[model samples]
Target: MLVKYRGSYEKVAMGLLSFIPDLKDLNNLTNEMTLYQKDESHVLYLWKNKDNDFSGVVGVEVADKYIVVRQISLIPSERGTGNSLEILDELHQLYPDQNMMGSFDTTKLVAKWTEHNRHLNTEV
Candidate 1:
């Protein structure tokens, strides 16, 4: 089971930044998602398991009507179980009404798997 909810970027940013301080910009980056929730300009989704375990997050930024998947991450334990792809799929389904554009980063083996499964470009 997956749950989707509207949340404050401050809370998410605080939690994520504690782990990656360099991601401080994420706090501000998510602002667009917060403000334009219905415009499809940007959106953020946090993923949790059926057991309510926090898994990861995916964020997309829309520019020039292009949906750029800006970030996606899963906790260590959930990495190999296909939860990440499920999250991505959920996001895609959520915004099926839009035309999206983005490339997956394939430098990491896990990224390659995600790209292959999702059928998205992995050069980035």
Candidate 2:
């Protein structure tokens, strides 16, 4: 199941960094989250396993009538199982009227997956 994440989910969110080597530092993640939260510009949701284990997080920033996906990360153990797509679908359903955009490093595997699943342009 997916749930809104509060400050307590910080650790689990930080743990997800292992999947993205360039973002292995918790301090950087914390700083970004803190800034976003303080600015009231971001909302985060987490997907939990049946036992309530943290599986992944989807971060979105609202911009006018659209929602820009800042990041979506799944733990290594949960990769390739369609959990990320499930999360994206839930977010889309929750805000059906809003345009959703997901951004990622163009060189990463995530960029390829996002383009395939969301049908977004690779050049962006």
The candidate maximizing TM-score is 2
Error of 1 at 20 (Å): 5.7
lDDT leader: 2
Candidate 2 per-residue C-alpha lDDT over 58-105 given as tens digits, one digit per residue, 9 for 90 to 100 = 778877788877777787788888777677778877777887776664
lDDT agreement of model 1 with the native: 0.56
By summed lDDT, the worst window of 10 consecutive residues in model 2 runs over 105-114
Residue runs of model 1 more than 4 Å from their true location after superposition: 1-9, 17-40, 63-66, 103-124
Residue 9, model 1: lDDT of 44
lDDT string, candidate 1, 5-94, tens digits: 365544653453234234557655455445536656556667787678666766667665445666666666777787756775676576
Model 1, residue 21: displacement in angstroms? 7.8
